[model samples]
Target: MKIMIDAGHGPDTPGKRVPDDSMREYEFNSSTARRVVAALNDYKDVQVEITFEDTRDVPLKERTNKANAWEADLFVSIHANAVGDYWDDNVGGIETYVYLYPGTVAPKLAAIIQSKLIAYTGLRDRGVKQEDFHVLRETVMPAILCECGFMSNHHEADLLKADSYRQKSADAIVDGIAEFYGLSKDSPDLVPGNGNQTIDKGWWRKAMNLTIEQWRELAAELNRMYQDSVSGKIIPPVLNDYRWVEKAYKTEMTPEELLTVMSIIQMRRIV
Candidate 1:
């Protein structure tokens, strides 16, 4: 079967950047496309056709046109996630999207890719979602978009730079495709030039590591504290202790201290 691998965004889109300003989304997405193509190429039974060879000049519509013309069995658009203004690149994680009301295999294909991305990347699973995407909506086959990690997040930006991640990312994409189309080891649909199609049993272990509900609770609590401090609604014990307030950065100073002592120290003079 033929597969169209579209590395989303073209040469026109410089795409997003990292905190250290080291990694670019265009570079990451393009590199991932290459890795995916190579892996699929290894399977002679599959013909991996890439739509975005030179992202610098490739137009989004043109890429979609290529996929439609190819009559591919599936189309996977690889991309990284980015949010907010350039000054604060913070929100990120893997969110694989399928067209809002896609064809029969759209949901199934997205599920296959989304599960594998979290399993191998060790990143937060943003879950499989629906987006009114132009490419996925117009494409003739099952499609998915992978937002690998957040470019705004400082820690994840560092992780994306590692060389090993590229290979693993490619493996995840390839393995997922193989599994989705009933192309298991016994299937003749398996990629050619391989004796056995290895399954990643370790996926379960990685999946058990991250849970979104836990983080959501943590964020909720943090916001609640900030709100309480603003409204003077916090516990009196914490507010009364000058040192504790300072530790939490909620209050100004020790009430017991004389005005003379407080006036003596200027805001500029104090750390």
Candidate 2:
């Protein structure tokens, strides 16, 4: 499959920097886009190309033109979001967008990317949305525009700048594409862990050092939290706290923290 990856915006675009003016959106987008292309290239029979090869801002029309010319099977646009005119450290999450049309291939692709991104990055799910984004509307094939996280949020901005977080983002995209195509280890040139594992089992075993039974118990605790939230026993503030939980920052997690997060997600589900 041929995939077109568009790293949104150009390096010279004004006022697209992180809250501290430390990094440009293009810097994060381009770096992550390149990593995603590299990961997808590791798979067999997959061809990936970036919409813009350099830091220069290519017009939206030209970007779509190239994808259409290549006859790409999928188009993925990577971006970092800013909610307001000013920085807001508290606002953050992962969201994916498809064109504002029903029953399109874009929504499916967006949903796949959104779920994997939430699972791998441990970000709050802003959910899949319908938007009239140029990249989503103009692409000829299955297309999705992924807002990795809000750069205005300090914690998320730090993650966006980290190489480890970028790799995780790329890995999620690759996993989504592989799942959509049903690519497996047996496929020519396919890489390992392609839909074979959902969560990072190795990371869990190595970092958390928990046994299978312990993990199950933790999951059960999360379920109980969800039940409580649904029953309206948990107040709004407590619900909000658990709704935006993040535990996999750089894959560092204490057992207590992990359990808290697991419980939070469970609560989020029922609310």
Candidate 3:
């Protein structure tokens, strides 16, 4: 599949910087866009191209034109959002946008990317939205614009400046695209395992240093948490806490169990 990645805005774009002028929106967008290109390259049968190759703030028409001319299968535009030009701690989250009158594929792709971004970054779920963005409207193929975080929000501004956050955002975007297309990696190590492997209960017990009864108890607690989350009775855990949960039981978790854990984590409200 051919993918076009556009890092929104140019380095010199006016009023696109953080409140303190510490970082430009393109600085984050371009970095994350490059990471997305690098990750997509690892997948088989995938050809990736980035529109913002240099510092020039390319026009929206030119970017979309290139994608259309290239016959790209999909287009993704990366951006850091802002509320006005001032810092506001309360205004922050990640959101993805499709054209106001998008085709079937654009909304689906937007939803996937939105979910992945929130799950991976533990950012606020601003949900998928409709917008009349130039990139979205002009691209012939399915297209999405991701607002990684609010640059006007102090906390998220710091996150946008961090390499780790940019990397996470890129990984989430790539994962979303791969999931939408069912793309597989060229490397063996990245391939998912078949589900038929037998679980060695004894080994897992040793690995987690927990007995069968203890494992059952933990599983029961996780199930309860999942149910509570489903019922909207409790906030979901943060991604870091979810990682700890996964690390604690990954050796023993069945595919089904793993899904349950992920559901619980994603459902948790980020504080």
Candidate 4:
């Protein structure tokens, strides 16, 4: 998938710094964006485009236009939120924004991102909201604007200045996107090729949305089906068609199991 990432504003953007001017918002945004891109680089067939490579300001129009011209599958703009010019300990939380459209995929994506961010960072969830932000309104694909935290908040500003916190935030964002795309870290393609590795909870959590009991039952059923197919009791479905399998059985098999089944089916077709 092609993803366009925008680090909001420029290094010299006025009124974007902490009250003490310790760190700039662009510094935080750019670093987080770079980390996110690095994390996604581990995946195969993922094409990431960054709107700004340097500390220079890129116009909002230019950023959206580049994403549209590239036909990106998704657009993510990252920024730090602020309520006033100075610091306030009371106003700190994470929020995600989508264009005010009922049927678009942006809301769902925004929800997933917001949840993951809160889960990973232990940040307060301000929830997903609809807005007429320029990036959200202009982006061709599903778009989300993530306000990472309150830069005007004293505690959050300090956290934003730290590299570890930035990395953690980036991780949450990428993991959320991976879940949206049904990309499991358990897939051999993501992590090391270990047969004993259990399926990543991401697939089960996002795609299945099943209760614990339901997941257990479905997993048993998938194992039975795989065994049956291998023992010649029944023919396996189309192996080369991942999309079909994904659509047909949304949560039946884990990603690793799906990969194994598809590989076997494809090999059988060739043989």
Candidate 5:
């Protein structure tokens, strides 16, 4: 599924910062958005597009237009909330929003995100709300905007600045989306030469006499080979065999190619 992630506002956007000016809203938003993209990559059959930049504030119309043009399945806008650009110890919590007239799918998406955020962050549940935000209203797909915490609140501001909190927030958002769509993590099953058979993890340990760490190292090497193959730094042996075939393709390597690369790597290890 195609997902669009928007980091709300920009570095230069006026007044979207902590009262002490220690942190910008875009810093938190963009950081969390990036983490969300990386986390989502672990899921199979998922594609993500980020709609905002670090340098400039992208207009809401442009952000929604890009999602619409890409025909994205879902759109998520990430932001840090504030009230009146001043510090307040009392105002803090997590909230998520859908369009005022959100359709069936958007409300469900918003609820899932809201619940996950509160669960993971241990933040107060501000609950799901409806707003006529430009991104939510203009995007054709199901879209939701998340207000992670109030920048106006000093306590929440500190949490937003921490890497651990950003990571947890990103994970919660990805988990929510995955739950809604029933996404599975990429697994060895995506590898080609196993004849669609599920490999038992225990069997790999017994047959290869390799610890879990060793298996992970091997997988990491295979992943490097796949990256090299994709970048044209090196042609995977399997690809040379299919050079004569013509087919439409995405920028990402296909499952068959990835599987064949793994097979070749495994054979080399045995030899």
Candidate 6:
């Protein structure tokens, strides 16, 4: 499945940022998009594309239009939350948001995202919420704006700043997306660099971040399950990274590649 990733605001917006002024919502959103995009690439059956890239200020309407244009399966806008109504020195938690809709998929997605975010980061769960935000209210598909962690809170602000946390947060979102919808992980087109014939045949088109791996040769560090699977050697551990091939997408995976990708995903054991 193809999904649209929108970083809430541009770099120069002077938008939401941490209290100490170190991090901004744009930074957090963009970085999480990148991490999620990178992490999801293993499935080979999914494809992810950012609505707008590099300094391009895609308006809220334009972002939704892009998703509509692509008929994207889901629309995810990432952001960091503010501290409080009065700016007290304390406050922190994870909140997943959707527009006001009764018994809609948005709320379900929000709840799953909220739970996974809490589980992955050990952050406080503010719970799923409904708000009439422009992006949330206007998007046609299942749309959710994740205020991943509170930039206002001292501990969460610092914690959200870490790449490890950001990566894990992105992974949690991807996993939630996969489970919520009955999307498949099969990718019949993924090629193992079999040659130009395989490349021209175009089996790897769905993946956004799919690329030739760095260490083409199997390393000893690779799990026995993957080595065994390649030759009926052993059963692979789910989401072991070394066992999974990164697909470069954030939406959903095809059925054919699902089990293989899960075996290769290193972070599968995370959440």
TM-score of each: 0.64, 0.67, 0.69, 0.68, 0.71, 0.67
Return the lDDT, model 6, position 178. 75
Q: What digit string (tens of lDDT, one per residue) describes model 6 on residues 142-185? A: 89988887877777778678756776788788778877875555
- The Cα RMSD of model 3 versus the native structure comes to 13.1
lDDT of 4: 0.73
Q: TM-score: which is higher, 1 or 3?
A: 3
Q: What is the lDDT of residue 132 in candidate 2?
A: 82
Q: Tell me the tens digit of each residue's lDDT in model 2 across 1-271.
A: 8889999999888788786788889978887786675556446666666687454799999999999999998899999999854778778999998885556677887788899999999999999998888888888788899999998898898999886687689879889988978865322212245355233222233337665434433433333343355457766534322112112312245767775675555344334
Candidate 3 residue pairs in backbone clash: 236-268, 236-269, 237-268
Error of 3 at 36 (Å): 0.3
**Best model number under TM-score:** 5
Off by over 4 Å in 3: 100-103, 188-271
After superposition, the stretches of candidate 6 with alpha carbons farther than 4 Å from their true spots are 84-89, 184-271
Q: Write the per-residue lDDT of candidate 3 for residues 88-176, one digit (tens) a residue.
A: 99989999999855235888888999999999999999999988888999888888999999999999999999867887898899999
**Once all C-alphas are superposed, what RMSD does model 2 give against the true structure?**
13.5
TM-score, candidate number 5: 0.71
Error of 2 at 36 (Å): 0.6
User: Which pairs in model 1 have colliding backbones?
Assistant: 10-55, 11-55, 11-56, 44-192, 89-152, 90-152
Stronger candidate by TM-score (2 vs 5) = 5
TM-score of 3: 0.69
Candidates in order: C-alpha RMSD to true structure: 21.5, 13.5, 13.1, 15.1, 12.0, 9.6
Pairwise lDDT winner, candidates 1 and 6: 6
Per-residue lDDT, model 2, residue 118, is 96
> 1 or 6: which has the higher TM-score?
6
Residue 55 displacement in candidate 2 (angstroms): 3.7
Worst 10 residues of 3 by lDDT: 198-207
lDDT (CA) per prediction: 0.61, 0.72, 0.76, 0.73, 0.75, 0.64
lDDT for model 2 comes to 0.72
The better-scoring model by TM-score among 1 and 5 is 5
